[model samples]
Target: MKAYLDLLQDVYDNGVGKDDRTGTGTRSVFGRQLRCNLSEGFPLLTTKKVFLRGIIHELLWFVRGDTNIKYLVDNNVGIWNEWPFQNYLNAQDLGNLEKHSCEWEERLDAFVIRIQKDQDFAAKWGELGPVYGKQWRNFSGIDQLDWVINEIKQNPTSRRLIVSAWNPAEIEEMAKAGLPPCHTLFQFYVSHDNKLSCQLYQRSADLFLGVPFNIASYALLTMMVAQVCDLELGDFVHTYGDVHIYNNHENQVLEQLSRAPKSLPTMSINPNVKSLFDFTFEDFELLNYQPESAIKAPVAV
Candidate 1:
């Protein structure tokens, strides 16, 4: 986790000011990479208590090819709530409410309630429009996830094991309802000792709010893939593009950095679950994750 904090310090000290789609300014840098050893421990940030439940459920939702927020909201995950709620507001001509304002927060809360209680409304407005799930599972009718897993099993030495979420065709529709994929493409590699390594090329990164989850999510994904493919744990390499910290989250970044990082926690996954798609939320557990209180920050929507 020191590496994550170090990156934050680097960006905070050296990044340039840049404009973003959210109208929130950013301290931006071009390219950076973080590599973590899976054998050491899971890379869940110890500086702040991340929402492991949300991360797990969200990953599972992506694995199952669910494009709707219903699965998330139903399981008490609100990470994707703001996007579709904002989209709904825009469609109903309510886009003028200032983001993160008291009124906006109220409306967003109510909208999520509606999503949870009404299936029809959730199906219509909560769909994130073929973002990560669709691109990973069905990139133009190709099941990239299954294909990659099968490739890892069959051809351990193949360099073509990649899953991408940057579909240019539906990018506009995705932007209308939710965000296009920030962590765009990823590839898998197998070592001679049957160690599975993954490298993700993220086109956009919210360093303060999103990067931690991205690290843990991919680490866990690699672990699951290794288990299913009968391989050993390898490094999770995270390469970034346009990785930035929102100006509004600067103080929170400092707060998180001021705290000392604890030991990395171990993630225990049910060894019996060989199929990635069949993994349930209860099958994964985070052990020895003692961390400081969560540092809250506004997300750049």
Candidate 2:
């Protein structure tokens, strides 16, 4: 976790401030890499308590190719609530807005309630378009996840074991993808000793609020793949492009960095789950996750 802390400090010290798609500005840097050896520990952050439930749900959601947030919402995972809610708010006419004097905070609450209670509303508003899940499981009618898993098993040494979430065609049509994939692509490598290693190429990283979740999500993914393939856990290499800390989250970042990293936790998966797609939320568990405390920060939707 020191590597993650170093990244925060590095960005604050050496990064250049820049405007982003979200109005919140950022201190940005390009082309940085962080690696964690899985054998050492699970590599979950020890400085601040990460919401492991949300991380697990999001990864499972991606594996299922679920482009909707209804599953996440039902399971109490709200990490993705902002994007669809913003879209819904943008659709309302200004005349109606002025007449009602819309309270966005209240409407946001109602948005979740409606999604939970109304099936039609959930279908219409819960969808996140072709985000990670859609891209991972079915990219242009191809099952990339299944293909990659098979490649790892049959041809472990093949350099082509990759899953790409960045669909240029979908990005061009912005309506399909509300937001482009940030963790764009990931590649898997099998060493001679049958240890599985993964390297992720993230095009844009939200260092404060999102990077921690990204690291755990991909690390879990790597472990799951390795488990099904019957290989030893190796390194998780996280490479980034345009990693940045949002202006609003600077204080939280520093506060988190101030704390000393505790011992890394260990994660275990149900041995019965031999296939990657067969994993349910119950199949994964984090052990010894004592951390400092949760740091609160506003997300830049």
Candidate 3:
């Protein structure tokens, strides 16, 4: 994972400070790229332990065509609670939420519990409108995931194997929708040796908190496609625009860079899962994962 560490350092050294929508301020760079070889190892960050369970559940949820956070909360994944909680807080007309206060924290906790225990509340506030799953499964009444898989098998040499989450018509609505796609689009390439490779284009990347999960998520996606297509795994290329580290996480970023990365972990998937939509959270496992303690950092909403 030297590539990841290097990117972090690069942003620190050369990026310009700018204010963002979250008002966290960042030292950000534009247009950077990183590639991971799937044959080497799973590209999970070993410097700071990542929550693999959350990654697995979130990815599976997206594939299930679920736009609600109920599935994630039920499976103990709270990575996405901040946005919906913010929406609820806004509806309540709370002011000066620049930094979440003790009262705000308490209310957010109650709100999550309500989403878990109350189905109606979950339906009302837990849904991220037209987000990743909705876009992937029902973009303009077309299932891009199904189309891509069939294209890879039917015409391996075709260059049109792509799935996009960026709908221009919905961009204005997403501005206030509390959620938008960051990993915007991805394209697949098939090699002469029957290997499948994928490249993702992310519009805005949070280097410290989000990039690691993005890497693992897409790598797993590539592996699943390769498995169902009877092909070998190749590379996972990550391209970014406006990649930045939140100013508050400066210390944690340095701490992570100071630690030497351990050996990359391997992932095993159930061989019986023949379809992309058939994958469940239980069908995935991370093997030989030994890492340093997880570094705690605040997420920029």
| Model number with the top lDDT | 1
Candidate 1 on 1-301: residue-level lDDT in tens? Answer: 8889999999999999999998989999999999999999999999889999999999999999999999999999999998888888888898888988898989999999999999999889999898999999999999999999999999999999999999999999889888889999999999999999999999999999899999999999999999999999999999999989899998898898899999999999999998989999999989999988998888777
Question: Lowest summed-lDDT stretch of 10 residues in model 2?
Answer: 93-102
lDDT of 2 by residue, 1-301 (tens): 9999998899988889899987889999999999999998898899998999999999999999998889999999998987788778777642133212347667878989999999998999888888888889889999999999999999999999999998888875434436889889999999999999999999999998899999999999999999999999999999999999999898998898789898999999999899999999999889999998899988776
Off by over 4 Å in 2: 94-102, 174-177
Candidate 3 ranges with C-alpha deviation above 4 Å:
none
Give TM per candidate.
0.98, 0.96, 0.98
Q: Is candidate 1 or candidate 2 better by lDDT?
A: 1
Query: With candidate 1 superimposed using the best TM-score fit, by how many Å does residue 85's alpha carbon deviate from the native?
Result: 0.7
Per-residue alpha-carbon lDDT of model 3 for 1-301, expressed as tens digits? 9999999999988989999998889999999999999999999999999999999899988887888899999998999998888888788886456546788788888999999999999999898888888888999999999999999999999999999989887766555646578999999999999999999999999999999999999999999999999999999999999999999999998999899988999999999999998988888889999989999999888
Q: What lDDT, from 0 to 1, does candidate 1 have?
A: 0.93
Let me know the TM-score candidate 1 reaches against the reference structure.
Answer: 0.98
